[model samples]
Target: MKTIGRRMRFYRTIGAKLKGGEMAAILNISQGSYSDLEHDHAKPSSDTLIRYCTETDINIFWLLTGEGKMARPIGEVEKEKEENSEISIIWQNGMVVGNHQVDNDHKYLISLINTIQAAVNCGLGKEVILNYIAQLLSYTEVHFKREEEIQRSIKFNSLDEHKESHKRLLDQLISLRNEVGSAEPGEHQKAILEILFNDLTEWLFRHMLDEDLKMTEYFNLEKNHRVEDNSEE
Candidate 1:
């Protein structure tokens, strides 16, 4: 097994109890990638690592160095759990965009943000946060293409405008990433996180509720018509 994957197996078998495909789903990665990750052939993206650590409460120290316990100390773990739980966006079913794939993708994206927040709350470090942001932006581009495909399938009226919006948001994130990448790592990165986080909260969370939900309505109506016609036949 690869180093991280071997450590992940230890982390899993030692303390955590999760199903096989759960990590892959949470990371929005292919099952093959997860499998390869275990064998040490494939490396995890920043988003995946952050998601894994956040969900399992695995010690970043243990994950990297493999010289410590997989889980945090009980006292610190409890305190951190309480702290992290206090400031999370509680995901709910109402956010569903009526399309299974789109809804699931949205769920994963929101979870990524939360994972970063949890890592930060646990005081992981600016390095982890910076890496997660870069990974998050890359994954967002992949998701945008999926969303655009759905838009084309449904003939979404605002497809052109929506594509533009996606491009603009992506450009903003790329700009932020470049800005942060050039800066020295330290206290200043927190300000960058704040700006990026706020933008993400607006774009990912708020956009889901405001814009994606409306798109859901349109898509659902189209689906219902198809269903009704099928039933008649």
Candidate 2:
């Protein structure tokens, strides 16, 4: 049933309980494209197919190859229910790392990550979780850029090392974002979600408490030295 018409119709029917706009939003596509998909006027993108499988109970393996059960089994449901352990708890004020602007950005990033965690912990819909992930990734790119700018301005001695670390986290975020947008659903998908979420949350803590603190300390020292030099003059 991989024929364009059959595949489109099958997926459309599966999601028929929801509005075309709603499904389109979940897949990050336009409503017109979703209608075209349902009518077989256009093909579903890999991301759309993946979102369908993720939001519905459809076994993506079967949807792709048509060789397995169409519906996921109860084991997945059990795993979903049990897998919500705190991925670094709620953000607290202790996370602040000095500079007001930088601290504000970190707070926003923390809120975004916390939203992602809430999605997993509260058994939120797959679409909701993915949306939060997208928000986190977008904001992270902005935050990292700003952080790097601050580092450059300060001429922080550790800037190179800090930038390298930022690159690694950016790579991880891009990889996870691509996987979430296109990977077929199953145990492996669930595992990817958990591992990536943990990776991101932990990175936030590490960067804020360690790397960011270093930047703060450097600026503080420079400011104090300038004060002492001015007083001596």
Candidate 1 per-residue lDDT over residues 83-153, each given as its tens digit: 64435554555456788888888878877877766766666666777788777887898888999999899
Provide the lDDT at 91 for model 2. Answer: 44
The prediction achieving the highest TM-score against the true structure is 1
- The per-residue C-alpha lDDT of model 2 at residue 36 equals 53
What's the TM-score of each model vs. the native? 0.57, 0.54
lDDT value for model 2: 0.63
Q: Which ten residues in a row have the lowest lDDT in candidate 2?
A: 1-10
| RMSD to true structure for each model, in Å | 17.1, 19.3
At residue 137, candidate 1 shows an lDDT of 88
Reference-based lDDT, each prediction? 0.62, 0.63
Mark the regions of model 2 whose C-alpha exceeds 4 Å error after superposition. Answer: 1-88, 92-94, 223-233
